[model samples]
Target chain A: MKIAIDAMGGDHAPEEIVKGVEMARDRYPELEFMLFGTESEVKPLIQSMDRLELIPTTEVIAMGDEPVKAMKEKQDSSLVQAANAVKEGKADALFSAGNTGALLSSAIFIVGRIRGVERPALATAFPAFGGPHREFVFMDLGANAENKPSHLYQYGILGTFYAESVMGISNPRVRLLNNGGEEDKGDDVHKAAHQLMKNTDAFNFLGNVEAREIMEGTADVVVADGFSGNATLKAIEGTALTMMGQIKEAIKGSGIRGILGALMLKPALKAMKHKMDFQENGGAVVLGVKAPVVKTHGSAKANAVANSMGQIQTMVEGKLVDKTAEFIKENADKLKVKKAAK
Target chain B: MKIAIDAMGGDHAPEEIVKGVEMARDRYPELEFMLFGTESEVKPLIQSMDRLELIPTTEVIAMGDEPVKAMKEKQDSSLVQAANAVKEGKADALFSAGNTGALLSSAIFIVGRIRGVERPALATAFPAFGGPHREFVFMDLGANAENKPSHLYQYGILGTFYAESVMGISNPRVRLLNNGGEEDKGDDVHKAAHQLMKNTDAFNFLGNVEAREIMEGTADVVVADGFSGNATLKAIEGTALTMMGQIKEAIKGSGIRGILGALMLKPALKAMKHKMDFQENGGAVVLGVKAPVVKTHGSAKANAVANSMGQIQTMVEGKLVDKTAEFIKENADKLKVKKAAK
Candidate 1:
């Protein structure tokens, strides 16, 4: 399989991106990379890696650039070129640690969406507790902020497919992210979406799951609109960071004993940190699209980029995009018929 | 000053409820309590304490009961009676560690909304980092599941007053809770709300605030619709719990050195726990109401209940209801005039 890499993006750009490609090449000998970036910067970093092919691009999309405009105008930019490679069938997947919006725009406009899909959602993987599953899928993580009930229902279907195909979960219990677990909870959109999802036999529906119960691993796929999902995702991230900061302060204030305790608890603390780290989780995938497109954090280093490559490889090997397209094509007519009947 | 107590509410009921009242009475000698519950269950717990009056009632609202229906039918229930006491001017405020929905129902139906207030919001305090202010107030924490742009604008006004008066923060910076900090972020409702808030001089509007910046003390007041706010609030709570659970597992898996390290770091961990504890932050306050009504957690023990009482006492002493009424009355005409001009 071949993966397209946007090397002129993220904090550690060309250097880390090239290093990551090298690492992935060493690990997965069957996999190849088409690195897109300025030749001068990316060429030195390649270091005679045989499996890697440099696709030189002149322009670079800055982190703060407007997404749609940048994608449209910066045709020669690494991000756009990388996405185009997937569009032209030169690469199986597109990977980037660039400006999220720009990457999303490129993925949607360049890599394209699956047939019969209204909107593609960005799916984030969050670590879960009290279940055999290590993590669950949360979708629309900021793709389409304003979503109709139909959009949300589609997210459930897309999330279900992604969970089953990519995450290797069978049946992948899907639940609507809501204020309360009860059937009669949430706003009008949620209520309508819940009913639609409940009536469908496309996946395992587990009713509405509250945000407090989400981390408890109550469901494998939690679907929500982009707005609520983004807020909830950030809230979880912020709370974890705040708690860790508070713990650090506590350790600092405890004098000599605290310093010794820190040394003894280093391994445990490291383990906990690793568990909470986004780098370990690879990156968020843009589902409902024609091809696999992963967006890692802009600050992601070599290891995280390598993990993202591995994740993309898995998605490609598992034929997630093809499966999603087939599912949507098969069920789109049935869903419309059901809606008309209702 | 007098406060009404729902003695038969919460998991602990009369035992912890009466104990909390006693603790509050001892701490604030100027305050008196009107405990509402069955005399058989509450009288023994009261222990003939001075300034404590047991108002006997027969009915009890279960935790799982429908809020509106329970409040209407269970008129003689402790939750209903306590709210009635505040409405009747027999108590300065009402405090409960009960079914949150029931308490909110009673607060709205019995105690009533302040003039010009369309909906009463539930405001929760979250701890902040690296600031003189230890916490900030987040509003509409699950009061109205479906909120219009106007409702969110009103929340800003209500949240501003609650923060300044009750939280004792003068000229508190108010922000709209959105998917991103950018002005163009969020759904349609948020965009309209942002425009409304920006046009107003009633509060120190700080534009949009993302969920990730909430715990970092970026703003003094974060206003969101009930759906997003509740999801964000629960996400924070769940993340904290999950992290603590993970830490426990880590310590257990780390052998004797880790156990000894835990002992040495016990005080620091305890301090960190206290900071994150809901009891330390008191409880969510029902804002835009005629009286200060606070709802503690359902499983609240004596200390949490006591903290909630103290919070209510502070609200009553600061005349939060009167101030809110004044602010609304003063700004209502101006807001209308501005709307007409627009």
Candidate 2:
């Protein structure tokens, strides 16, 4: 399987990207990489070009650049070219650690969405600490500022497919992210979505799941409108970061006891951080697209990039996009239903 | 000043409720409490009758009872009667450590909304670490499953008054809790809310704030539509609880070193927990009501109950309801504007 790499993406850019490519290439013998970046800069960072082929390109999409505008203007940019490689069938999947908005734009507008998909959702298998499952798929994580109830219903389908095809979860249990655990909770959009999802024989519909229960592994796939999804994801992340920061402060302020405790608890703390790290689950997959379009955090190191490559390899091997397209085609009528319209 | 209390409405009920009342009664010589509950079950828990009066009631609103349904049927319930006391001007405020929904229902239906307020918000002063403030007020926390742009704008005013009158923060900075930090991020309602707030000369409007920044005290008061607010609040809470649980598990699984670390880190962990505890800041206030109506956790102990009393005292002393009413009267035209219609 071949993966198109936007080597000029991310804060670490060509250096980390090249190192990650090298790592992934060495680990998976069947995998090949088409690294896109400025030849002069990215060429020297390459350790071994055995399974890695450098497809040089100019222009870099900065983190702050407007997504759609940048994609339109930066035609020769590595991100755009890399996306084009997948669209042209030269690569099985597209991977980047660049500006999230830009990569999303490239994934949606460049490689394109699946036939019936109105919006391609950004899905990630976040860690589920206390639940039976180690991780569960959550989607529409800020892909769009707004989403219709029908879009949420679509996310359930997309998320279900991702979990089944990629994560190997059989009959993935899908649930709507609601204000309360009850069926009759949430706003008009969510209430309508609950009814829509509950009535469907599409996947394993397990009713509504609250934000407080997401980490508890209440369901295999949690669907949400983009706005709430974004807020929920960020809140969970922010809380974890803040608590850990507070612990660090407590240790520093505690003097001798804290120093000794820190040394003794180093392993436990290390394990916790590792579990919480995005690198553990690779990057987010922009599902409902024609091909696997993945993105790691911009600050992701070589390990994270390598993990993303492994994730992409699984998606490619499992034929997630193809399977999703087939499923959407089969559920054509359901996908087109406007029952959730206000 | 007099305060009505729902002594029968909690997991620990009359015992914890009476204990909390005694703590508050002893602390505040000028304050009076009107406790409503089953006389047999509650009379034994009372230590002092000075400044504490028990009003016997027959019905008990169960945790699972529907809010509005229970409110109408269980008229003589502790929660309902306490709310009624506030409504009839027999009590200055209403406090409960019971069914949040029931309390909110009673507050809205019985205590009533302040003159022109459309929806009352559940406002809580959650702790803020690594910032300029100890805690910042967050509103519309599941009070309404849906909130209009005008409601969000009203939260700004209500939250500002709570900060100023209750918490003594003057010219409090209010921000809209949005999907992104940018001024132009979020759904139609939030986008419209941003525009509405930005143009208003009524309050100190500080653009948009993401859920990630709430802990960092990006704003003194954060306004959000009820749905997003509920999601954000739960996400923050769930994350904290989950992380703490994970840390405990880590410590337990780490053996001798972990035990020693736990002992040394005891004080630091305690301090962190204290800072994060709801007891430290009291319960959520049902704002935009005719009078202060508060609800603490159902499992709250004596200390938490006492904290709520102190919070109620501040609200009453500051004349939060009267001041909010005055402000609403001044900004009547702004409050009634429905610019966020889809």
lDDT string for model 1 (A140-250, tens) is 899988777777788878888778877899889899999998888998888888888888887789899888889898899999889899999999998888888888899
On DockQ, the leading prediction is 1
TM-scores for all predictions: 0.97, 0.97
Q: Worst lDDT window (10 residues) for model 2 chain B?
A: B333-342
Cα displacement (Å) at residue A58, model 2: 2.4
Candidate 1 residue pairs that clash: none
Model 2 Cα lDDT, one tens digit per residue, B301-328: 8988998899999999999999999988
Please give, as one word, the docking class of candidate 1: high
Superposed by TM-score, candidate 2 places the C-alpha of residue B265 at a distance from the truth, in angstroms, of 1.1
User: What are the per-model DockQ values?
Assistant: 0.87, 0.83
Instruction: Estimate every model's Cα lDDT from 0 to 1.
Output: 0.87, 0.88
Output the worst ten-in-a-row residue range by lDDT, candidate 1 chain A.
Answer: A333-342
Candidate 2, A1-342: lDDT as tens digits: 999999999999889989988988888888999999999999989877798899889899999898899999999999999999999999999999998999999999989989988889898998887656788999889999877778888888899888988888898889898898788888778888888888788878999988988888889999988888999999998998898998999999999999999899989888888787754569999998899999998898898899889999999989888888998898787765654352
